[model samples]
Target chain A: MNDKLVTVLADVFGLRREQIVPQLTKDDVGNWDSLKQMDLVVSLEREFGVELEIADIITMTSVEKINRILKAKGVDLEA
Target chain B: MKLDGAVSLITGGSKGLGLAIAHRLRAEGARVIVADIDNVALEALPDVFDRRSLDVTQPDEAKSTVEAIAAMYGRIDVLVNNAGVIYSEPLVNLMNPDGMMHSYDRFRQCLRVNLDSVFIMTSAVVEQMVLRRTKGVVINISSISARGNEGQTAYSAAKAAVNAMTVTWSKELGRLGIRCNAVAPGFVDTPSTRAALNETIIKHIEGLTPLRRLGRAEEIAQAVVAAIANDFLNGTILDVNGGVTI
Candidate 1:
């Protein structure tokens, strides 16, 4: 699950898969600016096939965190 | 260097400044939509308008109209909030100067159309922009009166708020290269201007303006194109008043 989340993050940020890790925080990434953050939100929504509300946007900080939050939001990540 | 083939949406487009801007942008090759309330005015709208009638002050109206546009056009590249109303009277002296004057309902109408509609329209479109990660431009048509207009209390306050929004939204949307800006025009000499103001007053305005004349609609349209073209010109409120506000 975490590896898949990393792949999603890498693709969203326009970075190589090897450049991202499960522990990658936004500050560590150069492309994770506000515009890119919004882009990340969109990419995640499309990846998980889930729609995020305003509050959910605040909670998605790291790859692991997004995966956890998506699961809690009833996304079937295993599939 | 161009907005050619891009999807552009202009609110309250169909008359006056908005219509002129649509004409200008379309001539530059943008696919445009003019959203307005007057059905007849919409008919005469330039071949570019791709008309959409909507009272942008209402949330449902904004949401449905934008979604419909996105469905039809695929994406929105530019949004111009040009639909607004105003009252040409002092806020306190509502009892009529000498009778035979209009009531003070100007405040309500002005606030509803000028201020409320901008919030609804931006909210509806920003969501789609965020989703698409689209680098879009939002041009909020403010007035030079936003700094301070004696007779136009509501209009001034609403435009001031629009200026504030230009800053806040620029901060919010900057990361994705989504630029937000405003153009504040002073004493523009549109057809409506000739109808609204007397000759003496218009002369006074022209005399006071450093440019010695009222501005034209196409002048403001030129500023709009500049903002959209130059990438570094984000979060700015361009004053196109011929140095009057200075």
Candidate 2:
């Protein structure tokens, strides 16, 4: 799951895998704005094969938050 | 992307253009839902089509209705924002003796129904599409009047805005695999138009148009279905006006 999340972040934000950290918030990332947030949402949904609520999308600012939200949506992070 | 077994919601589908679109889409194998504020017309739809009573202008109702449909069908594959009203009063009626000025209420009501409702309903459905990663199509029913029409200031403005937003949404949502397009029909021969428009006015419009006659609702509906079927036809307001705007 972490590897997939890193790939999605790297692909969607055009960031290096090393740049993606669990604590990396939108504020820390230069390219991660609201519009990019939506891209992230789409990428995450497609990658994880899980639907995400708009509320969850809005709150998903960091990798940690995304991990929790994906788990909440029944996506097995350990898989 | 195929219409077969896809779920579609068309607002204002109780009669006229909306009903025609509902029929056309259903015939193409879509599971159709016709939503309108008129309960009577809703009740009269055939058993093949699902019917829902809704006032699309209310945000809460829009949210709840979209949620209900998503719950039932698992996704909304198509959304036709067709609910709207037109008021043909001039910006100022100087001939009035009672001194009833062009009221704000009239203009606001037109915008509320025509413009605001589209935004509200589209947002609700697009959110669900975003969540489910559904490649949805949004068809906004626009009119030739969007370019300009005499004494139809409010209606014209609202439809023009719809066209603008259709383009905007197409750009914004295209990357998500969702496409937004519009069908701007010319004056159509419907029961309401036949009753409300006089012979002289109708004749003048017909003469002005290249086709020399008003369009049919079925023709407009066919254009809508075609728009949805075409994968690359996004951000375009397909003017189904038969060269009238020319």
Candidate 3:
């Protein structure tokens, strides 16, 4: 689950492996914007088999927040 | 619109491609608002339609026009940016003071209407759509001129930018379920084309097109509808050029 979460974050944000951590948010990265915010949602959906509602997308701003939210949403995240 | 029972706003919708699209959407039961710069054309607007006089080239005008449509109706489900104009001016002689000298005034006017108006309208409507979380669709009417028609340098450059904006907005607002796409039409026999176009030049285009004929406005309108209906088909371009631009 940790590995999969890291992969989804890196792909959407174009981040390096080390750059990805559970605590990262918009403040921790420069690529985050309104557009990339959408991109992150799409990437997460494609990567994790989780369809995020717009409200969930807004609330799941940081990597740690996304992981916690996905677990609640029934995404295995391990696969 | 939501395919049915939704509100739509079409720029340049008094006639030609815009009118055709409005008709098609209305046939499918979407409420339509048609805006254009010509009052004469607005008089000829279809029955039971919401028509307005709008020069979308002005930012405030576009904002006010779109906001009014939304307020009068309930929400804007579809936005079709189908307004544009063009003149034949090769880059080399576009500065000609006489016969060869292209009209700079006309070129600037074309960009203002075709390109800048698009930005204003999209910005205005999308902000509302975003706030409402409307998950709307935006279709910009582009031309094969974006593929580099020699006599339409200004048109080509402006439409290329339209294409760029489409992709940018698609990325910008996708999470809200808003999709952005463009439809690039080939030479179509509309009032504007009939006025200044030459048969010989058209013949040359037919020679280039595998279909060997000018496209119709309805054909372009069909492409626009397809883009609007397909939710997953976002950030892409649909060309109805009859194999001309391949």
Candidate 4:
């Protein structure tokens, strides 16, 4: 699950694979602005096929938060 | 880029020009979805085309409709923004002292249904296409009234904006390989038109037009299909209005 997310962050944020650590927050990412955040949410939805709410989107500022939200939405990350 | 297997969504597809476009696309083997605000009209749709209840003017509804359609089909290849309403009244009523002026509500409703709906639906669908990295096509149904027809102040403004956006969208989305264009039809002979205009008005319009007759709904439909099929055509507003230059 972390591996897939790392790739998405790298692809969307124009970061290297190694830079996309699980602990990386929005403040740490160079290009993570409000617009990119919206783009990230859309990309995540398209990637995972889960309809995320606005609350979920706003709280998904870090990898852990994203995982927790996805988990709550019944996304089986382990698979 | 064949119509076969392509997923196309046409708004206002329950009747008039939208239904004709649906039929044209369906005949070519495209998987089509016709969405309208009217549930009764949707119920009347044939089994070949999918039907859904959609009020394109509402922002949330527009977004969800695109999402739901994309979920059902892996991708949406085409979107025809055909849902619109026309209010044929002067900005101010001067004929009768008792008559009220064009109320703010009516003007706002016209803009909402005719102009704002196109913006809302296009943004939602385009975002989906961008995320999926899909090269898609968008055809906006404009009108010859965009050239400033009398008694259509609100409708003309809305349609003129649509034509402008067609060019702007083509420029912005062309980088992503998505094409955008519009079709401007003039006085198409539809059931709604027949009921709305009397013989004198119809005859006057026909006399002014080069073709000397009102356009058929199918004629406009053919133009839409042709625009979609032609890959090189982009940002062009194909006018099918019998050369009635105003």
Question: TM-score of model 1 relative to the true fold?
Answer: 0.71
Model 2 iRMS (Å) reads: 23.7
Q: DockQ numbers for every candidate?
A: 0.01, 0.01, 0.01, 0.01
Model 4 lDDT tens row, B1-246: 578778999999999889999999999889999999989988989999899899998899889989999988988999999988656766644332254367778888899999999999999999889988889999999999899976678889899999999999999999998999999999989987777665656776888999999999999999998888888889999999988876
Order the numbered candidates by lDDT, best leading: 2, 4, 3, 1
lDDT for B25 in candidate 2 is 96
For candidate 4, give the lDDT: 0.86
- What lDDT score goes with residue B26 in model 1? 90
Pairs that collide, model 2: none
* Chain B, per-candidate TM-score: 0.93, 0.97, 0.93, 0.97
Model 4 backbone overlap count: 0
Docking class of 4: incorrect
* Candidate 1 ranges with C-alpha deviation above 4 Å: A1-79, B94-105
Best by lDDT: 2
lDDT of 4 by residue, A30-58 (tens): 54545467678788888888999866776
Candidate 3 lDDT, A40-64, residue by residue in tens: 7888788777788756776776887
Query: Of the pair 3 and 4, which is ahead by TM-score?
Result: 4
Provide the clashing-pair count of each candidate structure.
2, 0, 1, 0
lDDT by residue (B1-246, candidate 2, tens digit) is 688898999999999889999999999999999999999999989999899999999999999999999999999999999888756766644334254355788888989999999999999999999999999999999888899776678889899999999999999999999999999988899876776565656776788898899999999999999999999999999888868862
